[model samples]
Target: MTDLAGRTALVTGGGSGLGAAIATALHAAGADVVVVGRDEAKLDAVAARLGRRARALTCDVSDPASVEELRSRLADTAVSILVNNAGVPGPVAALTDISVEDWDAVFDVNVRGTFLLCRAFLPAMIERGAGDVINVASVSGKRPLAHRTPYCASKMAVIGLTSTLAFEVGPAGVSVNTLSPGPVEGPRMARNFRLEAERSGGSVAEAEAAFVSRAALGRMVTEEEVGRAVVAMLDMPGLCGADVDLSAGMIA
Candidate 1:
């Protein structure tokens, strides 16, 4: 197991789903964790479940004022690990049918939020000459998903940002990488399947089957699998500038 004892980790969107799983895993590895999200109840639930090693903070990542407020709140805390996991699925539609508002909303959370958090926390890591940064991207970022232009584009931006930041901070002994999971089995994936079904005039089951067919494993990845990947990333050394694929060969 990766020994993260005495370290403090920050995971955004840690209220539920993959975020909560990652936070729990980090806490299990002996790290004090801060779970940040916009939903107070969800965040509180996660924090409570994580016991004394975890705490919750509410922040709207897309808003500068809110991010600044979060930075102020963490002024005295040292964050050794940062996970930029907050994201939206965005509208499933043809490019021509997608609205500017929908596209911007996806980018605001997936891309801008990651950028803002990195901006807020990276300097401290650099100053300490040690840290890990994981940006939760998607296989859609590497490959393309039809009718998911906004989400795919935003995640692609995340991969690009992660790669660039890795190079920029590697000299300071901080590792930066992207974790790209494919069609994770969860409410988010179910919702995406539903949206695709509506867009294609197909049944939700067919949409889900189509997604599963894209994976060599013929199934969506589990949340615990993602949590294990996060822990592996934290454990590995000299793993900078890598886009770690937890996509069940979907990218291949």
Candidate 2:
């Protein structure tokens, strides 16, 4: 079991979905968690549910100024665990149909945002000689997803970043790894499926079914499953510079 008592963990995009679940799991493991996201109310709601062990902080991860503000606010706080979960799905369209603005938006949140948070918090972890950084990527990064060009590209960048950071920081006793989830069952997944259905001239149910068919389990992965995987990653001391696939056989 991972004993995180007396540790402070910061989870970006912790307002809902996988981020919220991760924050809850980390708190349950005895870590003081700070949930950061753009939706203040959502963050507050999650924090309230987690009791005093959790607190909410509003932040737009894609914006440098906003990330800097977060850095300034937590200047005195030592974050022993950092989870970069904030990300955008990007526009579901072919590469030819995707505009530069849309592609950049996805990269800003999924790549630049993770980079900024690591830049802000990693030095302290290195100085302390102990810390964990988990970057939430997706199976889409490993395999091509037909219409999600920007999101796929951004996640690939995340995986690359995770590997590079792990090598650079491992000597300081800081472990950096990427957790790539498969087709998760959630509102976000539903939304993406709907968009795919429309683009393919099919029904949402059909699209969802097709997605499940690709998975060996013939079903979507749960948010709680993803949460448990995060906890497991934190508990494993030997894992570093690795791409942990929580994709239910989808990526394999």
Let me know the TM-score candidate 2 reaches against the reference structure. Answer: 0.98
Total clashes, candidate 2? 0
Clashes of each: 0, 0
Taking all chains together, the TM-score of candidate 1 against the true structure is: 0.98
Which RMSD values do the candidates have, in order?
Answer: 0.8, 0.8
CA lDDT of every candidate = 0.93, 0.93
Model 1 stretches astray by more than 4 angstroms: none
Task: Report the C-alpha displacement of residue 189, candidate 1, in angstroms.
Answer: 0.9
| Candidate 2 structure quality by residue, lDDT tens digits, 1-252 | 577899999999999999999998899889999999999999999999999878999999988899999999998899999999999898998899999999899999999999999998999999999999999999999896898989998999999999999999999999999999998999999999899999999999999998888888888899998988998999899999999998878977
lDDT tens digits by residue: candidate 1, 70-123: 999999999989999999999888999999999999999999999999999999
